[model samples]
Target chain A: MKRLNKTLYSVSLLAMALALSACSHDDDDNEISEVAPPQPVTYTYQIKVTNLTSGQPASPIAVALHNADMPLWTIGESASDGLALLAESGDNSEFLANTALLATASAEQPTLPGESMEVSVSIEDNAASTLTVAAMLGNTNDAFTGFTAMDLSQLEVGETSTRVSVAYDAGTEENTESAMSVPGPAGGGEGPSEGREAHDFVSMHPGIVSAEGGLSSSVLTSDHRFDNPVLRISVMRME
Target chain B: MLRFNSKGFRKTVLATALFASAGLAHSADLEVTVQNLTQGIYFTPILISAHSNDASLFELGETASVELQAMAEGGDISGLATATEALSANNIANPAEGLLGPAMSTTASVTTDEGNDVLSIVAMMLPTNDGFIGLDNWAIPEAPGTYTIYLNAYDAGTEANDEIRGSGAPGEAGLPVPPPLEDVVGNNGVGVTATVANDSVHIHPGNIGDDDATGGVSDVDNTVQRWLNPVAKVTVVVSE
Candidate 1:
């Protein structure tokens, strides 16, 4: 009886192998009939930015996915006109229209202090290995906080990466903190005036010297001052 | 028995060779760029070192070593460089050769020796009592790639931030005003503080410069000399 059981088991294994081969053969026939151009895959990313400041409000967050060939802004280099517009005016229209961007998205409204906003961007058929996110600190003169050319190539689907950002001076305009130069609620002044009047190169912001901090001409008060890591940004690959 | 001994010796030699090759594989060539991110603050000569993971330049919440104090207070990197060299560290001292001005960048190349898998950088910020930009024992990645790190200012805990013109010696009371900064920094100011409150390395409280260039409470200029955190940006490119 044991010998008979072993023979029967071997016979069943052979039959199963034959059945699997037959299924593969059917799949091959179907594949040949359906062979066509490959469909493009869409890669989508969800970006969430949280304002961690006490008083400073963030401009509408602008996010871009692109190759690593160019960064939105480089330290010690002059800010592009597009970046200057966004940093000084909180408008991202020109920035989003850059030719190098693979995909772009922006928050519909400014993110208030201690609040969070999420924006999604999608690209098809190409890999976006670099990501750039930026926003203006609405109360300052040409002060913006965000990161540029952050590597997103290693990010996998359903994976998230979080980072805190420091403030950068666009250097396109002086940090006058005067009511006429600041465009935020504190000053309600005109934004993005003509010319690169300051150092004309991007650098870390020296922070605000409010009226309380001895800038007698400053329209800002102590409440408008902030420190580093002003914005907490998180990016997740959704598809 | 003789044949067995010979075979054992051959195996030992092969293992030794493998270990030697592994050590060679761990070494890396690094091109490092240090950019003063501050709009106004200047960095003294920077010291970049590639050492073992066991060593560090400065530790937070701990008393700074004498070498660290000298570098932080006086922009003297010789002491720290000597200390690290004793540990077989590969060091590039004074990469900027002098004060690195605001928004300026300097690059240095170093080929790390065996076991030197971590990098440390330190530079004193001008117009501060004992504040320094520090990157403590950042592990160098084995894979070839570019890495960016932002360095924050630290208080060496060895002097008072008087914001006055004083000696740069250890246990000093004020900042070292170099010739270039003489015109920008203020003078004849009462010191900000007289005591070292922390007495241990910590994050800098930042400058409290009054706009009075000649007779404010502090000699530092609030608008021109004061800076926020992350005073420097370091870019490291790793190669074989």
Candidate 2:
């Protein structure tokens, strides 16, 4: 049998005993009378994201709070049209507006190379237990970075959750670094097109193979390249 | 203990029981999730382990053990797993089911037994011959909280990091490109190097790739395949 060690068993048993004792003490207080609910408290969440990529300046971040049942994207699944649009074009307006959110906000501006930006969102009554922040790396074809569905339940009032997130390919387009496809200043504002020919299933980004790197046909140079965890995010809950 | 009278003996036993209960509170039930923090590399299946205070997966500046070499070069956890099992260690092998790619994450739940209180994780980073992401033995906290750790890349001392495509078998040179990585990685490129500079496990120097896909200083794409340290993230939630 797969069993816990004796010490763990004893420890778990003691914890369970204590919890049971607490529940027993509360059994008598199960009153049927209902009272008026208190006014909802608005909790402000401040988000600060730093662009960790050497060259890529991240797009303005799209921040959202949703219930546990919601996830921005999942591996092996096709990205939502909104996600595809954001990943491909570096415009997060659609993605932000599309999320059925408990709360939502966006960074005021893009985070430049080695620069940081801040954004804030507020929820009524601490209703959201999960938060997700996403932004595109403007230099890539369809690469985006952020955390999806991170649980914020344990963050006490004024407490912060800090994390570094890796980049992801939306799989909505082939990583063709042509001037007509990339939307950054290096590529001159080329936005999303009707051509969506990539794998179409979200996966770990297989980074940009630049012209100075190893891809023979790529138009991007080493200055347009980047590495992992392109963004650092810190979220503080202020009630 | 027997010198006490009946009443005193009963009191002594009760005191022992209370002491035992206090010891139990020190152990934690932890659920661990490891996320690959790279944008271009892949991690060979991981070996998550929990051992005593004295044990480690691989230490910096130390020569790589045969077990460590096997794990870092070929993504084979069996040798390391065997070594850990002999020490009565807690282990979770191949938690990602297969290669965990760049910017990908996998979760493994492990309830560390009381004696095996420190956690470690190791796996080879693909597209490189012997680079690996390693978590040196970290002590699990006694308090119930969620702790997150970011891991750095390491070079296994066993093989020359000739960033070319070849075999997944142990004792062989070059990297093993899985089916998923075939399209992303280049082919017909010259090898990176033929010699091992450092024979001890050390910090991995990031890759330097050239522009030519067919004949270059490295087969890896510099923009696509290079990475900085802290290439993996581990989150542990200790349930009270």
Candidate 3:
């Protein structure tokens, strides 16, 4: 049986950027611009994500490539409705629909435990860019794992930057672990709930209290529990 | 606080850039902030220190040092402080004065002497047997920039998590129920267990709490006392 121990309850986003800032030099493209404002060069990146959890399958990943100045999520801030939708129900439709997005791509299927998924996204005519990938932990109330707006300009062509991502609680909903409250496969797979949340500010996820432990009312079992560093992402610039 | 740096500051930036490339940091001036991120869990007095690379506050998969054990079991930082002082380390103890309640934060500033290049932190969690949040010996960067680190809850593995009323002394059974915890923690738990299975420092499994108030399997509230990983968030701003 899994020990399903107590982990920290601090929300954190660890984004490690091994950057090489070689921006697009427009010397050659200047000749083409004389005819038409320079045909936009496509900056494409292949994002590979590996689910590292024991049981939780990562929901369809929502990959957003943008150049925003701020991070997609913060430790002490409240979750946006887009994040709430992805974290609570394993849905990325709302998150992808977020404004200020430069380009977006998503995985068509769930990435199960110990599995990897590759999705590519490209943006045209952009000089600066960052990457954000989000997916639900498909077995909890609001656990999601992904990277936040990581600067993509640091990666030279054919270079890959990697980081091991940890799970985060949306903090929009309480982690009650009730069968009705959980929208994961362990519960009913009902998806994100449309309701008021408990904690307004985001933090690290305190772990699940399953019936296997002592929360007799908890809908999660021992397998539903997890630890940190749940997802590993490798981002490489292709074009 | 975002400090906008530019070309006019190229000298320091270049020096820092070189040091960063070599993955080394010399003496640094730092403004540090730590936040307790839980909704219901409280952190006792905190300890933050900047020391040499050879020293560390806690080591994973190792036996608990007496100093770490005392802090984990009873929220004591005196021993650790004295030990750190012996190393001529730059350390701050209890910036919050007392218990840092849920979601509360504290800040401290320190200037590191040459060769003191690592940062470490510790704070016991209330209503737990031997759980404490820890940041063990992270290398302080040479560059002047803002860095954020998340702390994980660690079990000192010195005592059994009986989940009942008990003493706070090291090697003693039970938790130290301060006035604040007394109001929230229930009484007369039959004791969860008498022996600890893992007697070495490890990640805490968490409190096995029940909803019972007067009589129950455990004294801690299942909803309130349990926590997940990353009990604390530490932000450090390095300056020239």
Candidate 4:
């Protein structure tokens, strides 16, 4: 079995247990019930994504919560301009600013391979509250991975769920595998260069074949070969 | 966890919703769907199987079995198929019938035989020395729902990823360029590495390509052929 990166899970569990246990000692039920329509409380969530890949660093994550039916990206569909930017350049600026979100958050730096970090957002957590998180696999062209519109309404005050995500091709750029095309350290070239050539439909990523394999023009090596489940994501309701 | 909260707004409400736990305790029918999640990599024939707890196709940190090496090195799973069949594993072989192109998908239904409580899957990634995507010893929840799992790239550690043209036969040094791949992959000038650093099954480090399509260090296109982890997505829907 794989050893789970569950420190964040444990902390959320402990906090929830304490919150629930606190009620057991109180006889203030009558007092609590006497209060009139209570004010809506703020709900906060913490999402920690660990880079499970051996060499791929994760672009800083872009996170959003919405009470509306908003999908950040869909398989078989072309990417929105904002999403395309995030996927190709590892820049979450435009994605985080989209108007559909009730709350949003982003990471300031890239999450290096074998490292884990947290990016969080808080919202009303009301009906229709759903989460969308996205991050680019920094070493590739237009490949991003994350989940969108995961229902958050049902999770209790203290519960955590971990999900593994596979890479997705934004279909915004052609996979060129050249030193001047990839924006990561492997390519060290331009990011999100103009002139798109793909059909522009999102789909499962087709992997890169570095110079070590067959693409003699590629700047990457065997060390850059990766598989699915690039990210191990844990979402916890913090408050 | 159900709680009765009287926080000033209640007539009595269950403010929390429960997400169904994706586990079970019995036999099931599964509709397994797998999608190639990369832009440049192709998947060879896929092998999906259900077996007992004692059986696993591969384990991390372990040496590659001869059968596994055959698939990783040459895109052949016949040997492993025979070995698993002898163990009473229920399998669906080559759901796509041939090479699954980039970003494509294949679906198949598998009914678990008695005592076959675990599921596993594997497929070779084309244009590589010994790279494959696989799932090993995943416990099928006795209960039924849609379960999604992602697969990572793995190296068979059997050959040096020289990135040059070579045979797919066991103990070969370079990748096998089939007719379809022959057009996409570049011709070699030099190889990448001469040795395998970790001579055991392990996570793939990823690919590195250059720009010289005709002649350079590799035949791969770094802009077109590179990728990240999570090369595939597997969705298993267990009958309710």
Against the true structure, whose TM-score is highest? 1
**Candidate 1, B65-84: lDDT as tens digits:** 99999999999999999999
Error of 4 at B44 (Å): 0.3
Interface RMSD of each: 8.8, 6.6, 7.4, 5.7
Show the colliding residue pairs in model 2: none
| Model 3: per-residue Cα lDDT over B14-123, one tens digit each | 55765333434356799999998775688889999999878888888899999999999999999999999899899988999999987678999998865578999999
Off-target runs (Cα >4 Å) in candidate 1 are A1-36, B1-27, B52-56, B115-117, B141-144
TM-score of each: 0.83, 0.72, 0.80, 0.69
Strongest candidate by lDDT? 1
Ranking by DockQ: 1, 4, 3, 2
User: Where does candidate 4 stray beyond 4 Å?
Assistant: A1-62, A67-70, A75-77, A88-125, A135-147, A157-169, A174-195, A198-239, B1-26, B59-63, B171-173, B194-200
Better of 1 and 4 by TM-score: 1
Tell me model 2's lDDT, rounded to 2 decimals.
0.79
**A54: Cα error in model 1, Å:** 0.9
Q: What is the C-alpha DockQ of each candidate?
A: 0.34, 0.17, 0.24, 0.27
Candidates 2 and 4 compared by lDDT, better number: 4
RMSD of 1: 8.8
Judge candidate 2 at residue A41 and give its lDDT: 78
**Model 3 alpha-carbon drift over 4 Å, by segment:** A1-37, B1-26, B37-40, B52-66, B101-105, B179-184, B198-200, B211-214
